[model samples]
Target: MENKNKIYIDAIKKIAGSSKLLKDEPMSRHTTFKAGGTADIYIEAENEETVKKTVDFCRLNNIDYYITGNGSNLLVSDDGFRGLILSTAALKDTLEVNGEYLTCSAGYTLAVAANKAAENGLGGMEFASGIPGSVGGAVFMNAGAYGSEIENILQSVRLLEADGTIRTADACELELSYRSSNIGALSRVILRADFKLKKGDKALISEKMAELNLKRRTKQPLDYPSAGSTFKRPDGYFAGALIEKAGLKGFSIGGAQVSEKHCGFVINKGNATSSDIFNLIKHIQKTVLINSGVELTPEIRLVGKF
Candidate 1:
């Protein structure tokens, strides 16, 4: 490790426990794709306060860092990150309900939140029952499926700004659009969110979740390791249909293949590398543009050295 990293590691060890502060930790073990290299340092924050303090320390010390949650839509390069990866995933089980609203920490999984909503006889969160991400990531990307999005039900969020300040932002202030949000531009980290849902029949909510999950299992390549949809849905066009029409389904470059079951998904067939997945996605984009006359964009987030 470099001198700066060595110093920061030593400093952080004093603040956090050895178990939560890992050196050269594999990113694959934390991601849904199950493909990534080691991170120079993988640190977990117990709560929002720890996140703020850690980031503040890094900023003051000139240490590089990246914040991530759940690692669902991420694809880290083989060389790994040379900076600290501060994760809020340690706050996973923090959730509470108050009347019609369900408030949860950023690290809380979307699926778990949805289940909690259902348990409370709430309806809006049923659409997110199968989303493979956490509340923070979902809000950051305005994650949507089955015609519902986080923006639709979001009321407010507690965020940590770049300048070591914490504040609550309302849904409208977030500037949420289709699969996009202002969080990145503002350099903000979501700490928690309050979702406004309506009372509904418990049985109906459960049924909705079950129905969506069934659709996912039947249509998506859940049997394989993939970062959900490889490309964003183009306006008035479905990416999967376009790829399938281009005859690219089941296409392979190394171990990365266009899923035969779901053309939109690029799956790792046991031995795919980051380069293979990246190249396969680019190939699909070029081919789809040539055949369908519409350009495709990736929805997955890539991290670290390429």
Candidate 2:
């Protein structure tokens, strides 16, 4: 570590607590892919204040930093990150329900939130019951499944802007569409999300959630480590269908393989490196484009450098 970087880290430690600060933290330990190298500095931020403070500090010091929640849809490179990674993984337990609205901290997992909504007799979250990602991540990417997306239920999001100001923006302002959002381009960090739901029978909601989860378990490659659904659905075509048509299902590149169970996923078959996953994704894209004349785009966020 450089002397100047050490000085900056020390300042962060005083505000975020020594236990929250980690040096050379393994990236594999954080992401769902269970691959990659290390991050130079990692901070497990506990609340919105800590996140704002740390982000402001990083920006003011001209230090590169990335904000993450749950690390569910992320892929870091083998060479690792050269900057700070501020994570919201510690804010997973905070949630509140009022009337037809449920508000959760950014780090709260979607599965837990969906279950909690059912417990509170709220509907409209059943589609998210099996999503293995945090609330902030879902809202950031407008994540969805089973013909529903976050834009349908999302009411608003509390964000920390690049200028160090906090504001609650309505969902309509976000321009949510097909696994993309304006939040990233605007350089905003999601602190929390408010979901507007409907009152429904608890039994019916629970039953729906159970059915969806069962389908996910039966179809998805849960036995391996992966960022779910590697490719976005291209216009007029499904990415998985194209890959299958291209004869790339169950294909292997190093320990990274197109899942035998579902062509949509690229799984880490235990000894896979970040490079293996990257190469496999590219190969699938190239093959699918040539064979089907449709380009595939990755849904997972790539971090650091490949």
Q: For candidate 1, give the lDDT of residue 283.
A: 94
TM-scores for the candidates: 0.96, 0.97
Number of backbone clashes in candidate 2: 0
lDDT of 1 by residue, 103-197 (tens): 99998889999999999998999888899898999999899999999999999999999999999989898999988988878878899999999
* Candidate topping TM-score: 2
Q: Ten-residue segment with the worst summed lDDT in candidate 2?
A: 1-10
Clashing residue pairs in candidate 2 (N, C-alpha, C atoms within 3 angstroms): none
- What is candidate 2's lDDT per residue for 1-306, written digit by digit as tens? 233466787898876863388889998999999998888889988878888888888888877888788788998999888888988767654698999999999888998899889999999999998998888889988999999999999999888998999999999888899999998888799888999999999999999999999999999999899999999999988888889999998999999999989999999997899999999999999999899889899999999887
How far off is residue 147 in model 2, in Å? 0.8
- Against the correct fold, how does model 1 do in TM-score? 0.96
Clashes of 1: 0
lDDT of 1 at 140: 91
Q: Model 1, which residues run further than 4 Å from truth? A: 1-4
